[model samples]
Target: MTNITAGDVIFLIFCFSLAAYGYGVIHYGKKHSEEEKK
Candidate 1:
């Protein structure tokens, strides 16, 4: 089995959270804009 270090885990979490936050922002913005238009 391959051993993953603490640094690797932290980096993975950081990247994942960053991507998730960006996705959420984009999704929320789109939704809000569409709601405003209606």
Candidate 2:
């Protein structure tokens, strides 16, 4: 019981941050090409 309380929260936050960063990169990539054409 003690193990679950200490470790799980840290792991979840780390994963969530990575997912957010990936989304931002994809959005920027899509927009950048459009600007270049103009």
For each candidate in turn, give its C-alpha RMSD to the true structure in angstroms: 4.7, 5.0
Off by over 4 Å in 1: 33-38
* TM-score of each candidate structure, all chains considered together: 0.75, 0.58
Output the lDDT of residue 16, model 1: 100
Clashing pairs in 1: none
- Where does model 2 exceed 4 Å of error? 1-4, 33-38
By summed lDDT, the worst window of 10 consecutive residues in model 1 runs over 29-38
Per lDDT, the best of the predicted structures is 1
Residues 1-38, candidate 2, lDDT per residue (tens digit)?
Answer: 45565468888888999899999878887978766653
- Among all candidates shown, the one with the greatest TM-score: 1
Model 1 per-residue lDDT tens digits across residues 1-38 = 79999999999999999999999989987878756644
Q: Give me the displacement of residue 25 in model 2, in angstroms.
A: 0.6
